[model samples]
Target chain A: MRPRPPAMRTKRRYILARILPYGVQVDQKQMYFAVIEAATSLFGDAAVGLAQPAVVFCEGGYVVVRCRRGAENDIAVALATVTSVADERIALRTVATSGTIHALRRRMKPSRRHSGDEEVKIGETYFAVYRYPRQKVDLVEKGIKHQKSLFFTEADLEER
Target chain B: MKITDAGIRPYPAGDSTVARMALEAAGLGFDSAVAIGDAVHRPPGIEILRGAVIGAASVKEVLKRVRDPAVRRADIVYVDAGDTSFNRAVVSIKEVNVVRSIHAARRNAFDHVAARTAAEQGVAVDISMAPIIHLRGTKRQRALQRYADVLSLQRRYGFPLTISSGARSILGQRSVREIRGLCALFGMTGTEVTEALASVGWIAEPHRPVEVVK
Candidate 1:
């Protein structure tokens, strides 16, 4: 009898996440461990195994994680639950999810920068702000030589 | 589409100070946060609403406290769901804005009757993330299951639902998107999560005038 070919595997989904503190980079192994630990802690071992998560790529503050098709949300939740990587406090924000890497990469193009200076008031003091990213902001206070950082998001800027 | 965290306890009341906690919550992308403590100075660019969590052993005590001049003046009123009767009583009251920790009990806390009453009375149900973050092992599993059951009832009965961080400190707060993602585990869709977050605005002041008559 002829040898049978290996069974075809089910298709998977890839999630693109941007690690916070923008410049901090982590390796594939560390990223994979952090995700697995987070999923295990949140959903337990059986679900994590069922999700079949894998780190396909990790570099330049971005990570692509693959998981079983139906478990994309579970994996995304797990990724969000991760608060630390390599003993440092960090956050993984899901930028996009796709069925193929090409599409996800296209969707990950850099957003246009907002120019011109703005003023932000924190408590009783006011600071001159230069740039504000999704996680952190660059600000300069009066009479201060060094710039101070304040982390804020678009939702924080709304006046309710 | 204002994102609000309706259940945060600032320092002296909880863990971190009010200003620091609000700053962290704002940094996490919330437009407003209800500080469940005594009066605290508000932060710039963020709306800080005052609220109180009242836990009582009986219905009479809850009613008496709710009618008190000090308690009546709060922007939001959350009644702790301690027992089945208490839960039913709180949900049926039109003055009560939220029934907090409905899943804290070991088993299903509210039933179909309670759900219908809450929906009719315009009372919202809160699923606090605190217990899930604090509990472990089988206890955590049980809590999640209970939360799922409550969510199903909310879907069937059409009561307003709010998913809150129930955070005591700065580190405990999650971004609006993060909260929606976590809620996905409980079977809430993206639209449903947005609605729940938006529901906070209405539930905080359900009877407010939409526009001035004059």
Candidate 2:
């Protein structure tokens, strides 16, 4: 069967969003489920079905969501409502929206660790520290699973 | 107008420090954040205003709580909303800047009377994005219903409305654009969100007639 002509094809819009906390690996399928759940709950099944939202790319701490052109705003709103993906607490900060994936890619700024990783102890618990620019520091309690995370600054660490 | 987050719990209350939250807030497009606890660090880029939360069963108790030195020293004061009569009485108090957590209050708790009193006393009702973002199913529905009711009352009575992220951690902090979107879930317009973000500034330093310094 021949594909539909370019003019007949459905117009699409892509939204780029940065996942907060800088470095949590996200499964694309799980991210899709999370997005669909949020959109359906907020806008109802009918509206979400019409919008046809899908997660096309989830990498480099950024995600590109594809949806119908007219539904980008509603979809972006739904993206903001996404609090977690696969039980991991997170936030999707919408960076930009465009007609093509290439345009959205230009907005992706890959997050890099600013300094060497280290360990610190407060009380009996130990935490692994990950440093970033702007004096931002993230501490993950040393554990095999469900580790508690703490957000602080360089000054906060010094005082501790 | 300075865009201010009406509520944030930093340091001992949460994992993030006040300075760290301030840094995140600056990147999220806020000029100031109201730290609702014992937060001492004052970050340079974004303003951190000391805030005190009063949870009381009676107006007399609220009055007593605000008199504490810590509460008195706070740049802003918030009260947890209670039932209808309690809400009406709390809004008229001069020291209270915002009535927060109205989403948890029962239906019609913040009625026309409370709105009018709040408007008259310059007390703003806080609309937090936490419920819309974090809650699901029946709880989220109830929160939306309450916010919608409050929005209608605010429109009719012309009372000031304030928007807060209610963030305890930097991960919970959202950008201004995201906040506008979350607020839209409850029928709030972009213009309304902007005004709500700026209402904290108004509450801090209300417009008044100038007096001669001489």
Candidate 3:
């Protein structure tokens, strides 16, 4: 079967969003499930089915979601409701939206972890701290799976 | 107008410290945030107003709670909304600044009488984004319904409204743009959301009649 003509193809819009908690790894399929669930739950199946939201890109702590042109705002709103992906507690922060993935990609400033592999112990548990720009520090518990993260600052770590 | 997140819990009660949350809030387009506890670490560039939440069974309990040293020093005092009679009575109290958790209250708990009283007393109602962002199914739907009811009453009675992230962590806090979209789900217009974002400042420093200083 041949593909549809260019004029008959659906015009799409892509939304750029950053996955919060800084370093949580989310699969593309998981991200799509999260977006679809959020959109469907918020707007119902009829609307989400019409919008056809899809996660086109998920990498470097950022995700680019594609949807029908007229439904970007609704999809963006739905993205804000996404509190987790693949059972991991996280947030999706909308960065920008565009007609092309290139424009949205331009807005993606992937956060780079600063050079710091420090360890801090609070009570009996130990946490590995990852530092970022603007004095933001994220401490992930040292574990093979299901690690707890504590968000802190330099001052907070110093105080303890 | 100052764009403020009405409430955020940091440090001991939450994973993130006040300083870090404030830093994140600044980047998220917030001018200030009401930290709802004793936050000694104050970061520059953004204002952090101390807030006290009073959960009381009676008006007498609320009155007594407001006299505590912590509550006295707080820049804002929030009362957990109760039943209809309690709500009507709580808003009229001089010490109460905001009535929060209305979503948890019964449908008739914050009716027209409470709205009129809140308006006359300059007491604001808080709309928390947590329920919409975190809760699902019936709970979230109930929260949205409560917010819509509050918005209707607010419009009719000319009462001030405040929007709080109700965030316990940095991830829970949302940008102002996201807030506008979330609020739109409950039928709140952009202008209304802006005013709600700025309502805290108004409650903290309400306009007063000029007096002669002879």
Best-fitting candidate, measured by DockQ? 3
Expressed as tens digits, the lDDT of each residue in A1-160 for candidate 1 is 8655545657789999877544455878988898898889888899999999999998766889999999998888788777667875566778788999998887665533454367877666666644434433433454444333343334443421
User: Across residues B1-214, which tens digit of lDDT does each residue of candidate 2 receive?
Assistant: 9999999999778888899999999999999999999778888989889999999999999999989999999999999999999999999988999999999999999999999999898899999888888899999999999999999988898899988999998878889998887888888999999999998997888898998998
For each candidate, give the TM-score of chain B. 0.92, 0.97, 0.98
lDDT of 3 by residue, B63-173 (tens): 899999999999999999999999999999999999999999999799999999999999999999999999899999999999999999988999999999999999899
Docking class of 3: high
In angstroms, give how far residue A62 of model 2 lies from its true place: 0.8
Interface RMSD of 3: 0.7
Clashing pairs in 3: none
Q: What value does the lDDT take at residue B180 in candidate 2?
A: 88
Candidates' DockQ values? 0.12, 0.82, 0.86
* Residue B189 lDDT, candidate 1, scale 0-100: 83
TM-score of 1: 0.68
Candidate 1 per-residue C-alpha lDDT over B14-94 given as tens digits, one digit per residue, 9 for 90 to 100: 535566567677767888888886755766778888887788888888888898776777888998887666788778776
The worst-scoring run of ten residues by lDDT in candidate 2 chain A lies at A109-118
Q: Name the lDDT of candidate 2.
A: 0.91
Q: List the residue pairs that clash in candidate 1.
A: none
lDDT of 1: 0.74
